[model samples]
Target: MSSTETVRAGSGRAGKRRTPGRAGRAHDTREAILDAAERLFAERGVGEVSNRQIGQAAGQANNFAVGYHFGTKADLVRAIVRRHTAVTEELRVRMLARIAEPGDLRAWISCLVRPATRQLDALGVPSWRARCLAQFDTVPALRRIVVEESVATPSMGRVLEGMFRLLPGLPQEVREERGDMSRLLVVHTLAERERALHAGERAGTGWEATAAGLVDALAGLWPAPVTTRPLPG
Candidate 1:
């Protein structure tokens, strides 16, 4: 081969190697942005965090790193939520498949509660995801993103379906009310536990015990008797 042709071939090989390295760096940068954003958003409310702040926390010299990688603040929140949902979803799906009895309420409830707790446990100490989600739950715009990205998943749908099937006679209004209540209980409880753990305070048992406690509480909450009262005049 001509010397110029050999040089071009070598250049082609170098370009191929460099392309993957660049892509890998971009991936790492995006992950760093997400980690920084998650912690910041958890500590402060979502409304108080900015893209520039996230970029700075991610160690980017350029202020535009966050915006370039994740676009708006809402988009960034969704990305953070999505990062964990993929793992939690896999856990839920596996748990759902292993149910020995579909009619068992506790089993169905376990499917709902344990997957999240297990995910948090796997994430280990000082994790920000649970607290971050709790913050998102309070923001109207960001709450919608959470619902669309996390709560509306197929595994979650199956969990609700199994639970509702066992409560076939439950009043629709009461069921909806309890559903919202369950969400509040789960989100805040996990967030509080996460905070306590981060602060070096005891969380009153490990993640498994915490999951069992939540399961027991939710099982009672879901089936509690409702009394009829006259409407206020």
Candidate 2:
């Protein structure tokens, strides 16, 4: 090869080596920002937290660090949801694959609840994710972000599909109502347990036990017969 060609080849190899290091640093910065944002948002509602505060909490001296990395607060919330959803999705997908009976209500419900509880368990004590999600559930805009990013995933879609298949006889309106109920139940339950753990309070049981309790409660809730009220004459 010519001298010029050899030098160009060496430069190309060096660029390839440097690319990943740069990318890794950027990824680490983004993750740090996400961790700080999740904690702050959980403790103080999303509206009360600012980008500059998040930047400082993440150890970024640059005032624009959060904005540069994550754009708006809504975008940052979406990023945090996406970060955890990937892990929960994988867990749910694995559980889905092992489901033997399509009509088993508890099995389908397990797909919905266990993955999230399991993720929290994996996060260990003093986790902020469940509380972060609970906060998101309260804000209309942030809740929408959570629904779009996490709820709309393929694995979650499949979980809902399997769940609906088991409840074919349920009224459409009731099914929708129960769907909202299930979300509330799971979110609040996990958030409460997370808060307890964070405060050094006894959570009463481990995550597996919590998941089992939630599954049992949902199994009952999902299949309960709808009662009709007579209209006033």
Which candidate has the highest TM-score of all?
Answer: 1
Residue 230: error of model 1 in Å? 5.0
Off by over 4 Å in 1: 1-20, 229-233
Off by over 4 Å in 2: 1-21, 229-233
Best by lDDT: 1
TM-scores for all candidates? 0.88, 0.87
Worst 10 residues of 1 by lDDT: 1-10
Report the C-alpha displacement of residue 62, candidate 1, in angstroms: 0.8
Model 1 TM-score, 2 decimals: 0.88
